[model samples]
Target: MLTQEQISAYNEDGYVKIEGLFTPDEVEELGSEMIKIIGDWGEETIGWRGPWREKYLAEDEQQATKAVLMHNPHFYSATWGHVMFNEKLVGCVQDLIGSSVQWHHTVLHAKPPERGTPFPMHQDYPFYPHDGLDFVDCLLHLDDTPLESGSLCVVPGSHKDGGLEHIMGPDTAPHLPTDVYHPDKVESIPIPAKAGDVIFFSYCTIHWSNVNRTDKWRRSVRFGYHDSAMRPVGRYEDKVESIPIPAKAGDVIFFSYCTIHWSNVNRTDKWRRSVRFGYHDSAMRPVGRYEDDPYRIDPNNVLEGNTNTIVSGYKTNSEAN
Candidate 1:
């Protein structure tokens, strides 16, 4: 069960980190699995080559990178999801968004030392379009997420104001694109987590990560979930949908779709292994995009010539009412 303080913190601050959420063995298992997957795919050195490898890699390289344990076939198995969706995680979501949550999808984000780039600041709603306000997400640390490794930074309670409008204007320092949103009121909060800690927040929360500058890697696993009322609008892939998928040996973090979030770049020499899952409200319905609208539209569908749709699935949970 979630404590009153936790609930209050989340509501007021837009995000919260729960400590000792996973056992040491579980974290080690997930970390080892990630390392193995990277080795199997011949990506052990991919992180050392620098940040652009993900984009510069050949189609085969990209495919190989995706084939690791984070994207391994095992995750699709019932056994995988069963372990990933544990009682504590499910209970937390129920406390936040009711008992009728649904699983969406998953992705693993690996950051190698000096190979990761700064993830630009952006609201998640702009990436994913749906109705209602039940989108939520979680981040589970597989390693110590220290400040030097580029911990996640967030604009507290930004979710409460709905998604912020951003413009791709001039580049910020370090040649990164600047995301200008509601200024004067923006405050960046660094969220540091130890292994086994889980961070949860609303989909509308504005968040981003810095570049890793340490010798060690900061790895984490993330998952997102929504109430039954939300559904995909426009093309699903183009629309951002969050899901909670099962994994055999990692902590799960679940959140909503409106949550704005991004990961930091890895500057360390070690590998950062993180997995992500997205879920949606079972009741969510798809809506198209409008050019003049102030709210976020499904970028994949709203942008011309892009047509990827969201995939749907139903995972039954006995705890769900």
Candidate 2:
């Protein structure tokens, strides 16, 4: 439900792709409730508990669930807080962050099979910074991301060069300076997506991903939205070409938060899942790390409420799960 040339191609090529919204039985009941919270044909059927508890292990548990990465599964799945309050993705977040929207928190990048993991190229305001970029990352691709199975890559406008300063290499987290992606300074585009597609972007857009050399297993879920009045322009900077639009599954991508993206590494054997969730703008307020758990997936506070109200001090790796 957006067109003015898709809002002027998300304001001069930032990002935009909306095709199926969510059907196929709501993307097969949100991929069978994320395979019962990432059990993937093994065990761990739901019993959802989070707080990242050492990524939940009870033994080998398939080698501790391939280093599980599941933060805020709607705070322990009420079928993922009912698919993270999807009313056509909050009416496209009130048509791109306008009327009352707050509820920022949701992650479930469950990249399993063939041990998936390879997100570099950084910029989400250095781990969710805020204030001026007005945040908005809604990447839910739940599978069919090809490019040898690791699809998603960009550099189009490069968010007009904003946030580009992430040091310390080899993904111990803080990243960016890989000589600022030297392909003669930058030009990487591999945006393949399917299975319930959704790829909105920003957070000063520079993106990354690689290493799924597919054998089956690729998941996504990044829903994060903002604009209530914006806050947290703290600063710490660093930061697409190529928009291969071929959506299917449940298409919906709307970029802005400083667009520049990345993804590639699923060497295919099949299996790529995803499901992320987030929204905020209900008169803003609660800054940094959502000011102590300010979870609010609207629908009148979906699964519960937490308009915490803490102004600064941050921390969110799903608040350690």
Candidate 3:
């Protein structure tokens, strides 16, 4: 159960880190399980793009390893409605989002050293069709995460606001215009953790991470949950779809669909492994495509034109520019 102080902190800052939430032994077991899964997928490239396309078929073993890491097994018996829905986790989620939360999805992010890339700032719900309101996310750490390694950075209270407009950049969103968002911003707070520690934040919270400059690899497992009332924006893809993975250890970061978040690249010479899960409010309703409504601003992205911005240290990826 969460203490009054913990609850208060969450309410005030929009996020909280619970230390020593999981034992070292548990972290190790989960890591080993991930390694086994990666091995099973064989040598293949991993990421949003296809791993075994014609160009990558002849790459070295390292390239193959990268490919295989992205081929996560969504229905793996290890995660199938079991480990993710355990009583302890569920109970805590119930406390935050109410007893009616439902499972949404899961993702396993594995970043090999010198291979992971930086993830830009963006809201999780923007990609989905759900309405942005009253949702929560739970992130579980499976390894020790430090500043040198990639750790999550969040803008306290950004969630209470709404989404910001993003100008696409050359490498990211080249066609977009500049002078899109207003200036003064909030700073992002870095939340580091050891194995077993969990961090929970709302979907509307704005957050990002830094690159792993250390030689040691960083890894984590994240699970997201939301109110069931949110409608699905598109087809139900695998819970563990490929996005930019994080490079750190014992870092579990979860959020709701409406939450704004991102991660950094792994420049160090190590492997970053993490798993992720998504859930929804049991009472959420389905909404169709969000693009149709021009007057309706996505609460998750309300910071676009505001000059006084919070969490200004981290920038969105080039695509989000």
Model 1 residue 132 CA deviation (Å) reads 1.8
Error of 1 at 267 (Å): 36
Over 4 Å off in model 3, which ranges? 42-74, 77-81, 166-186, 233-321
Task: Look at candidate 3 and tell me the lDDT of residue 44.
Answer: 41
Using all chains and alpha carbons, the TM-scores for the candidates as numbered come to 0.59, 0.26, 0.58
Give each model's clash number: 41, 55, 82
Ranking by TM-score: 1, 3, 2
Candidate lDDT values, in order: 0.61, 0.60, 0.55
Report model 1's TM-score to 2 decimal places.
Answer: 0.59
Q: Give the candidate number with the greatest TM-score.
A: 1
In candidate 2, stretches whose alpha carbon ends up further than 4 angstroms from where it belongs are 7-9, 12-20, 41-67, 70-138, 141-158, 175-199, 202-321
Relative to the true structure, candidate 3 reaches a TM of 0.58
Cα deviation at 19, candidate 1, in Å, is 0.6
Better of 1 and 2 by TM-score: 1
Assess the local accuracy of residue 180 in candidate 1 as a C-alpha lDDT between 0 and 100: 40
